[model samples]
Every structure is written in structure tokens, then in C-alpha cells.
Target: MASMLKDLWNRFAGGGNASVHEEPAAEAVEYKGFRIRPAPYSAKGGFQTAGVIEKDFESGMKEYRFVRAETHPSKDEAATFSVTKGKQIIDEQGDRVFR
Candidate 1:
């Protein structure tokens, strides 16, 4: 019947009770002195790293460096070194200063 056909069409074509969702993925964070890039293939299966950190101590002087912090294979970690000018360097915490 017409009703039966319409029901079948609605079931297949209509967005009814289907679950719309997505898996959470890692995020990137940028700072004044550095930019963090996602590197999911590192020792950790899902982790991000600082692609480049530009530091200009004196005028017309530039330097680039890479930094990594200790973290679980799945969770995000802080940078091993300071990524910005205002950020503090705490030694008591797990934070490190990589030169």
C-alpha cells in the first residue's frame, strides 16, 4: 500500500534515530615563541609536539628549537621548555628546562 511504501522510504531516507557522533582527537596549541604541531606517530600513539619555537634574544637574532614533555601515550603534556616570554619556569613540578 501507499502507507507501507512511505514508511519504508522514511526509515531509509530520513535521518531518524541514528546516532551522529565523532571520536575526540588531539588539539594543537600555539604560543608566542612557538607553535605546537600534532605528531601522532611518535612513541605515543596520539601526541603533539612543538614543530618550531622561534627565539630572538637580541635584536636581529633568531633561533629555532623543538621541545617535548613527558606524557602518557594518549594524554597531552606541557612543553619541556618555556614556550612563551611570560610563562614561569617551575622546578618543583614536572616541568623541565631543555636547552
Candidate 2:
């Protein structure tokens, strides 16, 4: 009887375990109208990028425009660029715009 009770207790205690751990949700940062993924690297050896948001200037209507920059590590020194004009991509140069 004691052995049966111990077996029952162990079975209940270790019954079909599910996931032990779960992955954390991704972290994001927003700047202006862009949603930057993860966190921006430090300026020590990081590159900066820019994005623009506009409405439908292409079809002569209203729409949403979203642009993002490339991610750079904290060791490479290079320029990044992104451009958008009214839900349409324009030109990008060194993470800045030229008039």
C-alpha cells in the first residue's frame, strides 16, 4: 500500500510537464514615425539611418508610408540611408535627404 501511494504521488508530481520556459517578446523603439527594432547601438562605432512617412502622393490619394533604416553593429563605421515620399520611395543618401 505504501509503495502504491508513493508511485501515485510521483506520477502526480511529475505528470506530463509542458514548456519549462518561454521566449520573451521582442523589444522595439519608435522614432518619429518609424518603429526601430531592438535598440539603437551606441554612437561610438554605430551608423545612423533615417526614414520618412507620407501619405498617398503616388495615386493621388491617402495612404500610409513607412520606412526604416538598416541595423548597424557597434563596430562598423558606415553610412546608412532611407527615403520615402508620400507612400513612395524616393532617394536616400548617407541617412539624410538632399533638397
Candidate 3:
């Protein structure tokens, strides 16, 4: 009875297999004068995102931007799956840029 009570207490106190799972960090990729890194398990459904990263060469300080690459299923062709919506950031001149 004592062992069972202890086990119950441990479970309620978040001590029995309630540890947090840490995901692996993603490597940064450079493109168009900006670096992009994937945020680990931060999306709505445990998916990673391509985050814009900025680094200062002199101080080696890093910054993370909120803009991310996202894919959405086509509403019109949900069954046929003809097209997918993609997220993008554009500049005033209609050029793709990292936010």
C-alpha cells in the first residue's frame, strides 16, 4: 500500500515520466545576404519553421526574425491537391526579401 501511494504521489507531482522532450537544433543556411534557420517544434502542430536570422559579423551577435516560410493546402482543390499556397516576403519593388 505504501509503494502504491508513493507511485501515485510521484505521478501527481510530475515526477514519473513527465520530462520535457528537447528537439534537436537546426543549422543555419545563408541565402541572399541573410541567414535562415529552422525553429525547432515551434509551429502550431509541432512543425519547424524557416526563420530569418541575422548575425553581426563583428560582435557575432545573432537575431531571429518572425517571418517564416509556411505552406497551406489549396482550399479550392482540397481533394484534387492541384496547388499549394506558399508564404513569401516582398519588398516595395516586388522583390523577395527576408523580414
Candidate 4:
């Protein structure tokens, strides 16, 4: 029971299954002067939809990360969805997304 408790603790604490293989993040795509990188991660039942948006400024750089409620059975689909959602966000908010 001790080993089982330890395993449960690790899983809930985000340190379990270090040997499990993780999918590589999708390639970053450029859109309207912004860079979008899909970075979906494995979650229960499916891959979670998430990504990062970045822009370069004269002074430095800005970045924003987003996670959506959507989930997909395949990592590729999740990544594609992440990019699509990122494009929508960029189109809707532009640089305001940073704030």
C-alpha cells in the first residue's frame, strides 16, 4: 500500500511516469508578424489544446501562453487545433493578447 500511495502522490503532484514518452511540440508558425507555437500536452483521455504566441519588439520580446478546454485524441490534431485557435486569438486581439 505504501508504494501505491507514493505512486498516487507522484501522479497528482506532476512527477509520475517519467519513463512515459511525450510527443514533440509542433512547429512554430508565423502569422501577421506574430509567431505561434503549438505546445499541446498529454492529459487524461486526450491531448490538451495549448500554445504560445510571441512577438519581437524594438526593445525586446513579448510572449503569451494559452490553454483551451478542447481536447483531441491525437497529438497532431491537438497541435493543429492549437494553431487554429492561436490564429483566431491573434486576429481578434492582435497585440492586446499580451496584456
Which has the greatest TM-score? Answer: 4
Candidate 2 Cα errors over 4 Å, as ranges: 1-44, 56-80, 84-99
- Put down candidate 4 lDDT per residue, 26-91, tens digits, no spaces: 778999999888877776678777788889989788988776778899989988999999999999
Instruction: State how far residue 81 of model 3 sits from its true place (Å).
Output: 18
Candidate 1 global lDDT: 0.32
lDDT ranking from best candidate downward? 4, 3, 1, 2
Candidate 3 structure quality by residue, lDDT tens digits, 1-99 = 898566445533436542112222444554444444433323333332323344455656555433223422332222111111112221221122322
What 10-residue stretch in candidate 2 is worst by lDDT? 17-26
Best by lDDT: 4
TM-score, per-candidate, Cα-based: 0.25, 0.19, 0.33, 0.76
Per-candidate Cα lDDT values, in order, are: 0.32, 0.29, 0.33, 0.77
* 10 residues in a row with least lDDT, candidate 4: 15-24
Candidate 2 TM-score to native: 0.19
Ranking by TM-score: 4, 3, 1, 2
Q: Candidate 4, which segments miss by more than 4 Å at Cα?
A: 1-24
